[model samples]
Target: MKKSISKVLLAAVTSAVMLSSCSKTPDESRYIPKTAGVVVDLNAKQLTTKLVTNGITMDKLFEATQSKDTSNEVMKAWKDAENSGIDMQSHFFASFVFQGQPAEHKSYISLTASLKDADKFEAYLKKNIANFSLKTQNDFKYIWEEKQHAVIGWNKSAVIYISAVDPSNLEKYNPGGSSSPDYGDPSEPMIDSATAVTDSAMAIPAALTTAEDDAQIKTWVAEVDHLFHLKKDETAGSIEPFAKLLKEDADAGIFVNPEAIYNSGQFTMIPANVKKLMEGSFYTGTVNFENGKIVFNGHSYMGKELAAIYKKYGKKEIDMDMLNKYPSQNITGFISYAFDFRMIGDIVKATGMDGMVNLMMGKSGLSMDDVLNAFEGQLTYVASDFAITKKESPYFPGEFTEKPDAKWIFSLKVGNKDAFNKIMTSPMLKEVFTREGDHYTVVNPMAAATMPAMSINEKFVTLGSDSALLQEYLGGKGHIKLPDGIEGKIKGSMLGGYVDLEKVTAVIPEDKMDEDEKPVAKKAKELLKDVTFVSKADGGDVQHGEAVLTFKNKDQNSLVQLINLGTEAAKVMQARKAKEKAYEDSLFAAPVDTTVVAPQ
Candidate 1:
């Protein structure tokens, strides 16, 4: 019985986070209070409608994966909310705010749901709260219950959860608690609940009853409310960058202020270079479900120094024509990036990495700049085929090896062939490489032959794990050509790629998994079997890009299928755990040997 309850509890916790499956329409950014330091908003309604139009509903999806004992409190709550005239499809925002200034900062995560039938929702919310009382009478842990503003409990340091109600409209829910104080230390020192003892069931410490502590709770509540209520003297608008992105038709978005993060002093452990890189840039990201695909794009506004470096040496125009050299069909996936490595070297210098590089190269009479000038920067990697090899073979495990081998072909455009050759032919390099007609082939010292090869030309240098792939490309036997449709999508971007999901899934080896896990792996393959991805990145005044994952299935969207896969995996995992638990319990509860042998 205990094991059964544990299994149910595990399933309940897993399903709770996945409960954001309801649908809702878009609402303005006004629902997010200006005080929010970071916010994530989801359009459950739009997603739900999209699923329903394609023949799948949230309820149906859940029912398909239902089991006898798994907890379904979240789904039940969703049904209740929907039936009570609540806008089933409304925008829900999760915001994180720093409660106080640096050194004494207390952070809180709050949620706001856009309300459609406010009166009906409020009545339903109040009734639900009436049946529940505070578990701890004196230990006040502030939790936002339903439409109620925020109930100030005894312990002010507890994590709070808030609902979607206007701050101005919350007067009715405010009990006659002490008015928010004007000024004083608002930090509530974290209480040690594990060790502290109390007479009450909640174990409220005696220190909490002091007048100073009680007043601190009032001050904390006032501070939380103040975050939503903008000050008259303030001029810098609340989350302007993020709000603008929301207004621009983004289904969801997130933002973080560098100044706020730096001042928080919570990130003192991060490296200086990384911190500079983050603090010197502002980022805003958006998600959109359009054109039968889900697209996520992030735009970065680089600080002055970084932008200048990028403009000087990093920027390049991408030419899709280069993709024509690749095999037109039978290709699983490919990635291409247009970059100038020399410019990258310059950026490294600006970032203060030059000193470290110089120290490493000091004895060798080489500098970072000299190293960066050696070869071309642009690169393309193509995965043409995959095969299973055996263990007894000379080149690979003949028929004895169990794992599959991945075959890849890479082409890197050399910036300077002369410099590249000098390094390849250097004394240190001569030990591993032997000159072959126009390039070098890495040789096995004992075998003297079996090795991967690299080719160099005036325009490009190519390497292949399998020499046959390199020979094929050089011989023009199996050049890959991008489909016209995919080509068009990548034309104007500095970097881009396309992956054939069907081709990738077709190669999944079910033999790799245990007999029981094979079925779940097979299900995953089918779920994402027909998806394709097109991605691109562009550099300019602001660097931004998005990868669009398009699904070929007409019956359901990619997200719905993804959720189904997760649900299926969860069910499989739960069953496995239950089986293990039962086995464990049986060992302990097994009938003991009642026959007492002669005492030895």
Candidate 2:
């Protein structure tokens, strides 16, 4: 079974590679079934252009990685197909579609690619058909079993390979599912009819209501018949929402419908909590590349219930000026988000989770609002600096300098000092912390030695690994210093962070890395040495976020650096793997002593 599946996989890979090398662009919508749960569209020409611009062309990469000795027939055939007069400029489209309902659900994966020369492509498949476990029916060739089913077909300039699955059969492959014999009688009722009904009125529990096995089996059979007998131009039904997204020109993009999954009833046993969350939201995301970053923007449209909840709580703008207090120039990165604590209480009150929260608060002799109001709801996290410190080794003989530890500081503005003070001076904190002036340190034997000590000032509290760093912050010397153009990035953002890649990468000591890892790390360090990232997000009618990577040398932008870095990293990894393989071969090839020694 494994070997058969492997052959199918090999054929699929070869088909994709061969089709990718073709130049003809066929109508993508023809092969796309309307019932598709996800649709992926690839603009091969655009992607190839981008990759070539960055010195990481896919064709060259594949040629470079091709094995020298093609001892395997399947591989040799594939190489021939690739080398054959095929155009390598075309778009590719793939779709995942469901054909049946729950209990006996089935799915199909369809791939469509354009062919430069239909005659040559067909000949290639015919020559290599035996390499896969395939059977012929008319013009189509198919491979089907308990685990997987696949179909391959072509028409003129269009080529398609589809892999389908009967999800009901997956139970046979599930290792964790119960294999025990079923002692329950098939005729037994799911619920006692006498107790379930009274005077012709029937009451059914949610768990007891289920489609009978026989009914599900019939549905599965019907679906299978329909699938096998599908017309060449039959419309499976299009998910228009996702199809519309494809209209936007992009190098590549994907669309998924969670609501469709929820409605399928195929996996009806979704958790209650997740069901509520899923039913309360609709989401879609799009991808596009900018000058430096691969842009991803998404929207979560709340259902009536969730939307009402958001409308009740409202939103607030965070003051970026507050960010000036933290030592920005000294810190590698910092993330700060502002919220109104009362809004959280309001949300909990509006939502149904307040009952449990109130119960827990009552047990602690506190009100829910009081607990929520302890902090001002403005939170800042500072990753100031890092150090590679040596420690005793447990696995090896000598101590080795491990990875760097980021010096982090967390500051929270206090709204109610009285409430916070009471909690801070509680018996629990007294047991864990020892006070000196306005600061406290962990004196507990169980606490990690690296745990930060904390200090409290009027209307503010700060915690840091180093007391001096916290002092610097209190003295206003630890505030983040925004770069010249950074103000523009953070202007309307509710939450933002700045990452100094140069400083962060400088802390990564390549000299301390293992011999095999040093080269890879060195390449990464060199590539990212001048890159810095600033990301910001805003909350309103439509939530928006943007992250931009800035380079010291304008010529070496994020996209170019990323491509070059990936190329170099791949080379390093390939070299390391080759070296490891050679070592293994040498060990295995060592001559064995065949001489029998005389007994003493």
Candidate 3:
């Protein structure tokens, strides 16, 4: 299975990965062993099961929905969102549409726990999860039943919730859901329907009833909210390890059966292609119970096969109805305020999502958004362990047959939180995910034998401030530097390199002294002329990827010109789509602030 995982990764990165011709050693071959991973079909039944676990039964779910506080808060949040400027009700579109029926998603849960108890839970979670490390621990989340409320924490502000719909239901509304996927399911304990319980120890929830409690739930709700939000006084920086694990579990990475491809005959040529037509893709794990079994279904996918297949049939140009047939991988993923299909999805469909985002980001005609959306369709295979293969050189006959000191098994994905947790425990990932607290860490271990994962967070600093890149290996974070005494800033970032060069421009800083150019700007009577600039190894102007700011400084002003030596420009606005998606996903984290500031 591990070999097969390596093979699939090799296939996924064939074009992007760099290969070597090193000789294989017997010790190295013996080192590679079967990895410890859990893979299950996150089928429809499984998904539905996890959602309504004994802790949250169907009746309890609806009842919670009916609770006065829940209904009131949801209504208030809904109305505030509706009445506010952004209209998720319409002016929004998700990159990935889970259920095509245009369903509205909203979660209302509250939790409170002591710092000591929270730490215990976090430690407990780290102990349970294999490969758990302190460096990556922050990436995990924990959900605990506290007397105050049901606590869920990760990093700083973690909040886990349950949401999703059936694939069949998605096909029912969106014509573009033909490509719907089943990510993976929970194992061992039945994927039973979990009823939500407010007691500690996750006690079984009470029976359903047509009765109402006289105890002021509203007062309690306010206090709980205060504890988590306003009264955050001391709890603000506290770390809840269990909350962390719960949050990590909420991520799409864990739900993927990271071993699917190896199990597929086409990729490994070893494992018999079991007759399973549908394999779950990517999803947030569910902890529901049904018929005494727990299951899962709602999630996202790499959509490699589905997208390849869908595009082969020209599904991109097809309508929503065709989307129903689309692997219909969820598209346009972001926190939506409300459900308004026509204004959000339809309008964007007409104008092109990528193009619109580019325009929103002050650039036009940039297809980066499109490229990213498409990229998601691919990388799916890379998520598995056996997708990458090593020891295939003719120099060694008994390559993989032997082994070495310790086998190198790359993680499909590991955020700094989990990396931190792992760091606290596992020495392997700790050496890698070492960034420190407050801001957090990131560790993208390459699952491929030939390819290394993009080094995650080789630097750490305040969220809004600049941080120096530490590792020479990491691709490094986005950089924007301003020229000395110039009215323009030089900024650029590494893309998978899909940036649209034409749109990459240096914006003239208005704060600088541009008195000379001021006249040129005011008397701009002539048509815009294309001025070619020359590239400088040290201090020359840019021509090819370079350009000179030709403001008429007839007398040659301080040469305070704007130069776009920066990398290409694409829709960098949605670059935080994944992080932001995690923010919206109460499972991983939550909006600590009232509003999330756009990622620079």
Q: TM per model?
A: 0.69, 0.67, 0.16
The residue-by-residue lDDT of candidate 3 on 1-600, one tens digit each, is 011111111111221111000111111111111110121111222222333332333333322333333345334323322222211111000111121122322112121111224354355434322223232223434332222222234333222211233322446324234543221121111111111111122332323211332132323333334333332223211222211212332211122333332342223333222212123222223322222122222332322343233233231111111111112111111000111112232234433354546566443222333323221121111010111223444677765632212111111122234323433334434444445543334444453232332333312111210122122112223222212322121111000101111112222232353443433332332211222221111211101123333333333221111111000111121233345655567543544565554443
| Candidates ranked by lDDT | 2, 1, 3
Candidate 1's residue-wise lDDT over 246-324, tens digit each? 6555555666556455444545655576556545456678776553466777776666666776777755745444455
- As a whole number from 0 to 100, the lDDT of residue 413 in candidate 3 is 22
On a 0 to 1 TM-score scale, where does candidate 2 land against the true structure?
A: 0.67
Worst 10 residues of 2 by lDDT: 190-199
RMSD of candidate 3 to the truth, in angstroms, is: 31.4
Off by over 4 Å in 2: 1-40, 53-59, 70-124, 131-147, 153-244, 266-280, 286-293, 340-351, 357-362, 366-373, 391-403, 415-451, 456-458, 512-519, 529-541, 549-600
The 0-to-1 C-alpha lDDT of every candidate, in the order given, reads 0.52, 0.52, 0.24
Mark the regions of model 3 whose C-alpha exceeds 4 Å error after superposition: 1-255, 258-600
Ranking by TM-score: 1, 2, 3
